[model samples]
Target: MVEAVSRNSFKAYDIRGKVPLELNSTVAYRLGRAYTELFQAKKVAVGRDVRHSSPELVKALTEGLLDGGCDVIDIGLCGTEQIYFATFHWQLDGGIMITASHNPQGYNGMKLVRANARPISGDSGLRELEERVVTSAFAEPVGAHRGNVQVCEVMPDYVQHLLSYVDIAAMRPLKVVVNAGNGCAGPVIDALERYLPFSFVKIHHEPDGEFPNGIPNPLLPENRDATAQAVRKHGADVGIAWDGDFDRCFLFDENGDFIEGYYLVGFLAQAFLGRFPGAKIVHDPRLTLNTIEITRQLGGVPVQSKTGHAFIKERMRLEDAIYGGEMSAHHYFRDFAYCDSGMIPWLLVLDIMSREGKTLSELVQERIDRYPCSGEINRRVSSPQVVLESVEKAYAPGGQIDRTDGISVEYANWRFNLRMSNTEPLIRLNVETRGDRKLLQRKTEELLVIIDGFA
Candidate 1:
């Protein structure tokens, strides 16, 4: 009998868990072989983030892939998007990124994609992949016919593609503070610096697997202070910070005020609609008024998709949307294989600031005032489903209900979305009002009361 491999890391979207016990090199090696056999992938590209365990995991993963007669192009030490870029840009068979992506230091994970950079999630292929790995179902390696590994550099070409999104010559020189959070974005920023005309004030900019400053998640209130302070200290036009794998980026205004990601969705949609008139823009269900209103005002279609990268990308492909954004800071581009990029959003924001001769705050303030939101608040509970149904039962009668990804009830002046977390026993809540801060506060508390009652 084969010893069982832990399946704890196999999430709905990707594989992520604590290292050694949950996701060791043994598990990675088996996954590689199983992935090769399942997809019959001939040419695969693999990349890793700035995590200590990543290198070892990549080695074992590559060995298994090679054993299964798959040629491996190792794009060493890169953000998650770089693997996506390599897969689609080079027209390779598949790609795997070894990154836990803003998870704590002792954790690591992998994000897989097939040709054209299409996501491979639980409903897609990850479940089948998990079964194979668990059962040790893989063909024996024929040593004589094993494939080879090649180390390839993708930065120069990647930088060129990033610059193609905006007119560099039209951009004005502005002071910008960039916090890499000791992740993989620093190198990409360095590569793009020579081509752009901005003075960058770098903080924790170096890529360190140790994550000396912290785990690099800017979504947490405490993790945002560094970037905000830098922006104020330098009097920069805007401040940008990215997570461990540099997949989702967060922004801060000139006064060190953190700009909510919901507003940025509308901000980016407006930018794209300005250039590509009547284009379709995809947004998540968490927050919608600002994005929908802005998209409509600009004569662009706003398509709402369920939250998560796979769903958003699929929706974008179905709609052929010009852009897709989740309030969580994941921005997807049609040209970039409908894949999210932490780098692209900032570049576009800067371009908008440059051309309009406006500060980052000025560009997004109108939308913020129009849609005051209670940013995603999470509460631990005994039964998340019970709480969701309770909230829905209470509010569904009087409001317009949307059950796309979660329970969203919209009234005349206020709207709220209450959804259960995919990985935790927590219910995530988001409330927004039509320019009413007081209403936003009251409803948020009211919903919390209902949630706390269940607790």
Candidate 2:
């Protein structure tokens, strides 16, 4: 039986925690063994990010998988999506990505998937895996029948698949600012540069596990200046930034203004609806009016799923949605096994700009003015349930209340969604208004006051 292991890392979606304490070589090895036993995986693909602890953890994980008689295909030093690609692209039994995404340094995690690259989150198989790892549910290695390891290169084909999303010949010669934030996206940009016409002004481009330029999450307002300044300095037409694992990408306009991911949801929804009329577009509930209007205007259906990758992917498959997006910058495609891709969103945006003969700002300026939103604001609280109840009690009286994911209260001219973070101990609030920035600001402040009351 395995000794007691830290269960704090087993989150609702993936495994993430501080190095050695919550996650270490021992945990990774048992996880690999539990995963093989749970899914009966014979051949699995394993990929990892540039975290300092990744290589050591991956080494132990591989040994455990082999001990379980599961052959391992190592796709080294890759982003999370690469593991998904390697699994589906190679028809492997499953895939495991060693990454902590945007988490701070000295921390790491893993994203797991079964065949077809479908996520194995808490409800599906992760809970079982956790139980096994916690209680010692692994058998000894079959010495004679141990699995072998093979190193495979997935970058070339992955790049080709990304290029398939846009018409290369139609792309204009525009200067684009690409910021990898010292994560995994730099190599991807380099690989795609030769095939594109855009000149890239790269920033924090190399994969440095130490995070010399800070964590690659552009979602925070402070982390965005580097990408925005690069665009202004280089007179670039657009800017793009990706997180550590590159599953989510953020965009900036030619004016060096950071575009909210909420706007991009409606923008990309419109793009997909233009190509596939009457198709279903799945979106999260946090920010919805803009996406709903655009989807309906373009003769497409708007489906609202809970704000999460696992939930969104399931909804996409259930509705056969052509596309899915979150205000948090995760954009999913039907063609890419319903998996989210940070690379694909920017390429599609470039295609739209090239075809419409409009700048990035021009493309989204109207929507921005029409549906101004207070970008997602997070506040740490002691009791999230109490805070949520208080907000719902105060706001749900006259407004339309929807509890699909959280308490989303909508009035005729304004709307806001209040939900607790799934991974962290914080309450997240998103507020938007119909062409009224003043009302948006007022309501956001009002909500913050109520949220802060409990704290």
Candidate 3:
């Protein structure tokens, strides 16, 4: 049995915690054993970010993998997606990525994938792995079936795969600024642009484990300033920035305005549906009407799935969805084995601009005007269930209620969703009204009052 630890360390999606206090070499070693035993994986691909603590944790994890009789292939200092590529490219039985994504520098985590890049989450296999880790119930190998380590570079193929999705030759000359936020995206973007025709302006494009600028999460308003400022300063056509692992991307228009991810979803859905008519496109429940309308207009089917990457990817694979998107900037594609890419969305959007001869703002303006939303507001509350109940009761008389992903109250002219975060003690609220920004603001304020009342 693995050693006992705090339940707080085992998160909903993966194992993440602060180093030394919550996560340490011991924990990593135990997790390695548990993962290998659970998957019966003979070979595992391992990768880490440019964090100072990453090397130590990776070494411990690798030692445990070898102890569990699983061979390890170490891809040093790589983004999370490259580990996914390594898993499939090398035909490894499983993969483990040591990264906290856009989390603070003090935090670290691991994302696991089964053979063929299949995700292992709490519901699928992570819970069992956690239990094994807590108990340390690993069996010893019988013979000399020890694992070996190898190093291979997977970036060239990954970049080529991303570029394959868009036609760079047909792209218009675009002045683009990419802020890597001093994260792992630097090397990948440098390699990718060498073959493209666009004029690229790079910022914070070097991997600094110290994170001198700030945490690389673009969802936070403060972190977006560098990219937004760059867009205006350079008079660029568009600006793009990625999180720590480069899993999701955020965008700014020529005017340096932050474009919401929902609008991007609608735009990309339209683009893919144009090519694959009548195909299904998946979207999270947070922004339903815009995606549904856009998909219908483009002669495609719109399917709403629960939030988060794992759920979206599962639905995409089951339904063979050509594309899947979340209000948060995660965009998944069928061409990429139903995996989400921080790189591909921007590429496709640029292609859309070149083909339509329209600016990014112009392409998404209609959808944004039609479905004005008060971007997701998070409230810390003592009782999330009670707050949800209050909102449901208050709105139940006027419209339909959906508990699909969260508590979604729908009316003819407007709708909103109030859902609790899986990883934190907060409830996320997203409100949208039909072509009325003021109404969305009003409803949002009212919902905030109700949520605050529970506090």
Q: What would the TM-scores of all predictions be?
A: 0.99, 0.99, 0.97
Residue-level lDDT tens digits of model 3 in 150-197:
877788888888898888888999999999888899998889888877
Cα lDDT of model 1 by residue, 185-277, tens digit: 999999999999999999999999888899999999999999998888888888999998889999998898999888889999998999899
Give the distance in Å from residue 9's predicted Cα in candidate 1 to where it truly belongs.
0.6
lDDT of each candidate versus the true structure: 0.93, 0.93, 0.88
Ranking by TM-score: 1, 2, 3
For model 2, residues 27-65, the per-residue Cα lDDT tens digits are 999998899888999999998899889999999999989
Q: In model 3, which range of ten residues has the least summed lDDT?
A: 1-10
Residue 411 Cα positional deviation in candidate 2, in Å, after optimal superposition: 0.9
